[model samples]
Target: MRSTSQRSVVIIGGGISGLASAALLARDGYDVDLVEARDGFGGRAGRWERDGFRFDTGPSWYLMPEVFDHFFHLLGTSAAEQLDLERLIPGYRIFFEGHADPLDISASATENMERFEAVEAGAGHRLERYLDSAQRTYDIAVERFLYTSFDSARPFLSAEVVRRGPRLMQLLLEPLESFVARRFHDPRLRQILGYPAVFLGSSPGRTPSLYHLMSSLDLTGGVQYPHGGFAALIDAMVDLARAAGARLHAGTAATRIVTAPGGPGRARATARGVQVRDPAGEERTLDADVVVATADLHHVETTMLPRPLQTYPESWWRRRTSSPGGVLVMLGIRGELPQLPHHTLLFTRDWSANFGAIADGRVPSPASTYVCKPSATDSSVAPPGHENLFLLVPAPADPALGHGGEDGAGSSAVERIADEAIEQLGRWAGVGDLSDRVVVRRTVGPADFRDDLGAWRGGILGPAHTLRQSAFFRAGNASRRVDSLYYAGSSTIPGIGLPMCLISAEVLLKRLRGDHSPSRLPTPMSPSPSHRPPPEGTIRS
Candidate 1:
């Protein structure tokens, strides 16, 4: 067993994955230093505040409680201890086109089953059968696959996996849309079951049926909100990382990934450190035993490192498919929106056409949208008389689409989309004066995503988890051409979402320690700072 006490790790990017990696490594006796170009943490999960209204700018839904629990458990704590969580009674509500009434999905499975039965006579049984398979697959994924880096097949060769191999393979090969369509006669049910694929940064028709496990998280376990917006969650995460002795540097950008030669004939390069520019625009070197790049993988590989040291370079990125970009409209309304739940999804009747529009690089006219009224749950987010709303409208990941503006002040494409979405939400949700009630308005579009987060193709999420891009086919955590350099985040192995980001960090840890066990890492005894700090000497360019 090698001692990690003397080793230093430099993490580029202070997103969820980067922060998680810091917490893990810092607790494991490695001196960890994390740097973020942004002024604060959370990356896409960041927040915005104005006019006494605070909005969680990204990732509203708090699903997959088990993943959250496991990640916190690894840190010798629990999600219950770190977060003040309140589960929504009716997980979420869905509004269909031309349907005056909305369909409410409850936290109870039996109640949800009855809700499905009301829609279609035989749909309840079908949903039960569907959920049974989904739950089993979900269990299997959490236990066997999510934590494994897929560096090899060793982690998945268990006896249980072998017995379930055929069914699992069938799921991986089939499309989620087809699977849902075959079981439910109603399009609403189909939309309800299939919409989860979008959370994986993929369309139902393109994503594998194996991802149907997403339903088990929200539809069954129910959806929750962490009392104060996601910003509070970010604060907790920063606290955890800091408590574990990891140092986070905000407004610090990594200019280059410094590499040293290694292997026979110096064939491969070893990561020696990172070159960074501080908020003051001063350059320095962070000499490290390991470099974990948790930024957009494409950005780190294509721009930060030299061509010779790159594994997945510009050409490889050109062939990869990114998830949809999104336009986020944040509104502060002068009263309660009682009609809308904590989470509401408006699904267009012609789902395929809506997806097709995005595929064709055009915004859907009557786009399917998701709305989150956090004020319904947390009063602290908005002023006493106002409510805060966050809406996500998926669009083509094209930066040329333009950026967001305050109060729809700019005559840009982003504001146009925001205006249309306002009208769309008003009509569908039966709120005639929705636009009139807006006290404050802001929009975040594809170009905003690109400029703010370095999103690949302005994507809000990472790559799509399609058949050819899921599981083992997904890019691994480590660089093939760079020793001791690792990747973690939505763009890398294990896929998207906040839970998946935590799992991605665990995968990075596993790869570093040569641990192939699929079980979660046990909590360490009294997690103390186990290493000395790295030198602070600045390196001139």
Candidate 2:
């Protein structure tokens, strides 16, 4: 591998952020190596295959096309060339608990507006206004907030932001639930707009209205999927990282963060490298000039680093709010499910009780759930005659709730949730004989996230996006205690979701290069090392 720069970097975790960071640094001439505990890469964007059936076991939604595009551009590639992308029309279907027909939300702004009009008298026009405000804030955020190190208050206190300070502050202070409820009287309409806060790992009641920026994604930007599942995207990222001269070690668990010698305290001490336990259980060390940890921040802080060297200690985390964990059920069915779309949401009418139960650490009976039927768009996910279904039920961040298993092989509590979800789908979504059609089944609970991913509180996403945990208030990218030790992932700044993870890596690049500008990168470093794939449609957050 080329090592002309002499400066070497060791990245922990092989997730999106970790891999992206590795690819960017390696392309910049740093000798880089990344290690992951899991046997494969992609972290939460994992994949599973069986009997010619494949599943994107982790993230299903490909939101924020610009972030993905820019990230690939930085790596001397373009998303259009690196992978085949499909923009999902009528992006998703929403099925109410008692409604006979489902509401389809599409990429076309006019089509979605008409659907909104049909739901409520003036909601269509109101939605237009809502999205306008959301887009404005989103643009501002993309420019001034998402790509920064937060090294100073200048980004937030800029003349542009200060001019809009009162309005932005009002949005920040109000809860999302209140914001949506006031504008849209129809519960379905409100739920449609507010549900995104759930994926960000918090209920609308707790998340700030500023997150209305999320509306601009599906409502305006639409949803996207990469053919061959997310695994194909992961494969491309791995390929790029490898081409850029980065070494990847799977099944290698990093046990500790080694630091410079002769340091009496963590302050001002440089990171030496990472101490890891390999597949054979043999311990070894990988030396580095700098270390970037893109794993779950809680795991790296509480488990990988020694007491004094940890920037966020156990006590610090105790006081912070983490996002909700989830119950994930994957099923392979025996026949076509034309009644279902690629993306669907089953929202209960009484979401106040539904989401409240989750926030209070209880399972919402008839809980609001997200269902992904990727087979509608990708033929690679299942056998020719069969369909694939993945279910997500928002649950409390408690691992003791139980683990998942094939069929009902795991915890009774966890299985019960999965069982109820199946029945709910059959009842609300009219998917008759749903249970009988399941030829393959697997359920993942909070414990699996903890055991498999080292997720804090077994959270599916990292920290919750509460007003207190938003933006600069969130955990930083660099270690405040240890020099040369940095972090990039869902748990760190820029917050949750796949797009945020990509931006987090760019933020890390800025931090390392001592370029703290929050604006978009002026230009790609070099010509792309890829052939462009023809577009199926324009693409996401």
How much lDDT does each candidate structure score?
Answer: 0.88, 0.88
Give Cα distance to truth, residue 169, candidate 2, Å.
Answer: 1.2
- After superposing candidate 1, which stretches have Cα over 4 Å from the reference? 1-5, 265-267, 524-541
lDDT of 1 by residue, 58-168 (tens): 998888888788888888899999999999977799999978889998888888899999989988888888899899999999899888888777767889999999999
TM-scores across all candidates? 0.96, 0.95
User: On a 0 to 100 scale, what is the lDDT of residue 120 in model 2?
Assistant: 93
404, model 2: CA deviation in Å? Answer: 0.8
Residue-by-residue lDDT tens digits, candidate 2, 1-541: 3233356789999999999998887776666889999999999999887776788878999988989999888876799999999999769999997777799999977788899999899998999999999999999989899999898776677799989889889999999999999999988999998898887888899899999998998898799999998999899999999987778999999999998743665475679899999999999999887899999999999988788778899999999887888899999999998889899999899988987788789998988899999999998889999999999998999998899998789799999999999998888877779999999999999999999999999989989999889988899999987888999999999999889998998888778777777886655754122312113232100
Model 2 gets an lDDT of 0.88
Question: In model 2, how many backbone clashes occur?
Answer: 4
Q: Ten residues in a row with the worst lDDT in model 2?
A: 532-541
